[model samples]
Each structure stands twice: as C-alpha cells, then as structure tokens.
Target: MEDDGRGFSFTVGSSELVDVGRDSGVWDVFVQAEENAPLARIGRLLDDVADRKEIFVYPSITLGATDVRPYYTVDNDLSLEVARQN
Candidate 1:
C-alpha cells in the first residue's frame, strides 16, 4: 500500500483484480478463491509473489473448520496498473 497522507494507492500484478476509482485516486486489488482451493496452495502463491517483488502480504484466514471440511479466504487486496512507456 502506498499513500500520500491524504489518499491511498494499491498495486497489483497479473492474475488479480485491480479496481480504480474515477473520482478518487485510490485503488484496490484482490483475488478470491473458491472453497475447492486448498489453503496451502494459496499460501504458496502469496509466497511466490513476495519472492519476486518487494511487497507486503497479510495473512490468510480459515473461514470455517470441521473434522472433514475447511475453508479460507484472502484478507487483503492488492492494486496495480500497467506502466506507460514514455
């Protein structure tokens, strides 16, 4: 997350959702996974991205738990935009 005291910004890479506000300069990025995806897989993905870039990663959460079933979701969203050549 990047901020200028008065506003906030988010940057994201491929395979994520980037949301840009028209009036506000704020942006948000997020990736949602269905219940079928495993929690370990999501952690690996976050680890892989962090290894490639200098970024902050929030923890993952388990939505529900049971003896035979479990669920999880990403708590933080990232924001990104394409770079323009000069």
Candidate 2:
C-alpha cells in the first residue's frame, strides 16, 4: 500500500488469486466515505489484487465478536490474503 497522506495507492501483482489475465499489474483506485464505510471495500481490495486492478482500501474497521478461545488469550488475529492482481 502506498499513500501520499491525502490519498493512497495499492499495487496488485501476478501470481495471485485474483489474477484476471497475464501481464497483469497494478491498477488505479479511489476512496471516499462519511460516517459509514461501504462493503465494496473488501471486494475492491480483494479484486484489485486478484483481478489486477489496483489495491483496494476501505476506511478502518472495528469488529466485535465473542471470545470462544479456552486457553488462548489473544484478542485478535490479523491475516492478509495475497493473490495475483491479474
């Protein structure tokens, strides 16, 4: 993810799950939000990298869920999925 403070950019590469075609590479993107963010954020981000569009960005999100772990004390698990942008 690349950001210029006022705006940000994401680059998608090949050899990813979203690869739409060969010669796939980084695309372009735009984002805007008010008090609420759009759900397309996930798709856009995932698709961008996988489909060779661009990096997708959504407003920061806060999720809430019950803790079911018995011995695990970790509160959150963050994971990143990498796919081809093409």
Candidate 3:
C-alpha cells in the first residue's frame, strides 16, 4: 500500500475496490512518485523527475488505516457486489 505522505494507506484514485498489490512494481511507483521531490517531508512533499509519473494531486493526508471492504460499487449508484477473496 502507498502512503499519501501522512503514512496513511493512500489509494491512487477514487475506485473503492481493493486492487491486488502483487509485485507489479506499483510500490516502486509510489516510492518514486515524485523523484524531483524529497523522499521525506510534510504536507505532501513531491519532487518530479524526468521519468516520474504524476499520480496524486494532494500530498498531505491524515495518517489512518484503510479498512478493506468486502465489496465495491459497480457504478456511481448504490448497487454493490461481494469482492472475491484470494
């Protein structure tokens, strides 16, 4: 899981469903999110490098745990379905 600078489990986007965090190099992306920014800082410090990809818009976030849900909404509506366990 990626931290949104506050050490909280940061989700890259608005999709609520939990995504498999296998060795897909995703963590690398998060760690190197902004190469131009310092590796450590307060309030969403980000440094951009030539190869860094812009992901999160905000930097600082309240430190918290992200409780995994059993399901996610299929659409912007209230409809829901159970998430399959690995």
Candidate 4:
C-alpha cells in the first residue's frame, strides 16, 4: 500500500495501480475469488473527508459498458483475529 500525496494505492500483484484520491473521499476495491467461498473481511476503511468521518465501502467495478461487476461487503472485527495476518 502506498499513499502518493493524495489517497492510497494498493499494488495488487504486478498490475498498474489506480490511485484513489483523498479529496474525492472515496475508496474502491475489488473483491475477487475463484470459488464460491465467501471473501473474508478484516477491517473498515475509514477516512476523514472534509471534516466528516466516513466508512469506506466497496462499490461496483465499472471497467466498460458491459464489464460492470457488483460486490458486497462483509462485516468482521479485526480484534477477533487471533494472530491472523490481514
């Protein structure tokens, strides 16, 4: 993860990362899985945007007109993770 004077940018493998600007007050991520098993949650992505606290939620991925992928959020406490790597 890297913050380039704007927002955060995560390097998901070797692909070029998309920068999420802090001024936009939005953080978007893609939840991918090959199987039907559910994706695990670790924590909430919260940021103070324009003096207002907000929890960042995952929105739908829009790459093209016919390439929109919807995603869902799962709630989980990081405190409950015993020696688990996030």
Clash number for each model: 6, 11, 6, 0
User: Which tens-of-lDDT digit does each residue in 1-86 have in candidate 3?
Assistant: 77567554444452333344431111112233466965532122245432222332223222122223221122211112223343
Each candidate structure's TM-score, on Cα atoms with residue i matched to residue i, is 0.19, 0.18, 0.16, 0.19
Minimum summed lDDT over a 10-residue window in model 3 is located at 71-80
Candidate 3: residue pairs that collide: 36-47, 36-48, 37-46, 37-47, 44-59, 44-60
Ranked candidates (TM-score, high to low) = 4, 1, 2, 3
lDDT of 1 at 55: 50
Residues 20-63, candidate 4, lDDT per residue (tens digit)? 22112222344434378676443444643332122333343432
lDDT value, candidate 2, whole model: 0.29
Q: With candidate 2 superimposed using the best TM-score fit, by how many Å does residue 60's alpha carbon deviate from the native?
A: 30
Pairs clashing within candidate 1: 10-79, 11-79, 11-80, 12-79, 12-80, 29-78
**Worst-scoring 10-residue span by lDDT in model 4:** 77-86
Candidate 2 per-residue lDDT, tens place, 14-75, comes to 22423434332232222345457652222222222343222222232211211111111121
Model 1: per-residue Cα lDDT over 1-86, one tens digit each: 77667533445342221122131222233334447654322222445453422355334322222011112224333333222222
C-alpha lDDT score of every prediction, in listed order: 0.31, 0.29, 0.29, 0.31
Error of 1 at 48 (Å): 12
